[model samples]
Target: MQHVRVYTDACLLFVEHKVSWDDARKSCRSFGGDLVMIKDSAKQKFILDSLIFEHWNTQNIWIGATDKAKEGDWRWIDGSQVTYGNFANGQGNNHNTRRFIFSDGSNEDCALIRRSDGGLWHDYPCAFGLGSLGYHYTYACEFTRSGYGTTIGPTNQTGSTDISNHTSSMAPITSTIETMAPSTANPNIETPAPTTAMPNVETPAPTTMANIETPAPTTLPNSETPAATMSNIIGKKRRL
Candidate 1:
């Protein structure tokens, strides 16, 4: 069960479950997408407007972005290059925010959008379980929307799993991805087209016939030789 919004070819579902960053991502992926990746201002604004002040301004939400791959380089779980962000000024990887900095001195690199910062983004440790300040935060999940029509579910207050999927069941999201990311680096590059396969051909074998037996010719020349010899012998006897 989940709540969602369909915008253009994309769908963003606000999952109310209280899971860790990793678990939140897993739950989003369970619906055929990863955590919502807010790629551009338009997308970010869409999320903010959709959430409104009451839902977001008072809380934080997760996005499918992280610098866990390499400290400064953020990436989307869909393997997309980071290109757009709404990071609060001085936010993102290793800025001067204590919330972003862990006392344990581990990496705090997962991304989320906060209502406190006008729904702008902030980075926290991926392991930072539930909410921003030890409170549970609702998360958004992105999905492709080709065959899946756009839909919006009822609001979930407790972030529970009471909302079931309306457009589709737990079907595979193979034809879609809607996570947002930001980078000066090229983002959303299309994968190379797959090579086409050729058809097979067959050749016929040469024809072969079984061997046949032939009858032998009789000897006709012996008749002429014997008749000639008999005439000669008769002539010789008369002469004698």
Candidate 2:
């Protein structure tokens, strides 16, 4: 349930449901606050008196103080040391046996306010009794009043810090543009294939044997002078 009360410098939210200490703190943070931190006696009294008025029948309510970081070195959720404390008699010793272990073997690391003990503090198992142990109680949340507009109230549909109407200038954009798409240009250059065929023009070289051989001898008759010379010489001798 969404119920909140405003005091001097803080706003307290009382969640009337059972949850683990961690889950309780997370719920409070979801609404921009955290589990109530009772740092000093004045804050402690404010919490207790407020719980009394809440009328929550349960005796336990998760607080912000814990020793989860280091055993026996208790500190609030904000990392401030617990200089002031109102732990019940023999309470902050982790457990009854003082071995820092509960009956279920879980460590007592989270703090809570017990209404039965008039809002005194105790270190309890952070996750025990949340499940089968059947231990159930509610938790309270506190938001600093100074952070009212920027970090308070449930989230809205328009995603603005303010609760009522989101300012038009602060309204979130409906669509987003992609600025990192893959490039369409190719990364490698294309190379042409090499030609394999010989050239079309032939060389002037004559490869035939007949064209290269010498001319054959001519069989024409001998010249007439060789034969006439012999006959003419015989006829002249007889006449003489």
Candidate 3:
């Protein structure tokens, strides 16, 4: 195993170590970090320049980048998809293969880099058993910005100014939060019935008419004259 230290003042990231791919990853994780991913040419160069000339015998070191979660969907272990990588010429040809081999005979899927006499990037495979520079591995590796720095924040030292500026440049979100309130504060109100009252029934009076009778006159008075008397007698006979 071989170990080396690399630092960047601008990014405040420190990378150090050379261990087996597994051990290197474990070491980074033990410190609550992970192997570094070189996102740009500048960063790649910085790592390369930091290494000693002899260390460049290999092509590169295993990085904390892989697509093991989903085949062909290459991404870092932190769930970040790789937008930039430092693959050598005709490298990454074995797309479906699990192992990544550099120009050197070392077999590893991930690795870091340092420059050789020719000013070209070289790969250093992660070794498990050998011990060098406090790292029990032959290949040198680096830790990500979060892994190396004391404070785990954005790699940019401008205090996320880029993100803020981008937010200001873009249009604001149009969506608004809609708060719904009950139509009435009290839900117990009941509707009133119709105002018209029902009609009352009246009983008819009983019939009160009674039967009546008139007694016939018992007698008729006789007249003073004879004729009158005769008329009275006839009237009496008629009555009887």
TM-scores, one per candidate: 0.55, 0.55, 0.39
Q: How big is the positional error of residue 9 in model 1, measured in Å on the Cα after superposition? A: 0.4
User: Each candidate: how many clashes?
Assistant: 12, 0, 18
- Model 1 misplaced stretches (Cα beyond 4 Å): 53-58, 100-106, 128-135, 147-240
Compute the lDDT for candidate 3: 0.44
Winning model by lDDT = 2
> What would the per-residue lDDT of candidate 1 be over residues 191-240, giving only the tens digit for each residue?
99887976666667777776767768776675444445788989999999
Per-residue lDDT of model 2, residues 190-226, tens digit only: 8787778877997789866666667788789976665
Model 2 misplaced regions, further than 4 Å: 93-106, 128-135, 149-240
Poorest stretch of ten by lDDT in candidate 1: 159-168
Question: Over the stretch 114-172, how does candidate 3's per-residue lDDT look in tens digits?
Answer: 23333332223334332212223333334443334343322211122122112111111
- lDDT agreement with native, every candidate: 0.64, 0.67, 0.44
Worst 10 residues of 3 by lDDT: 164-173
Number of the candidate with higher TM-score, 1 or 3: 1
Which order, best to worst by lDDT? 2, 1, 3
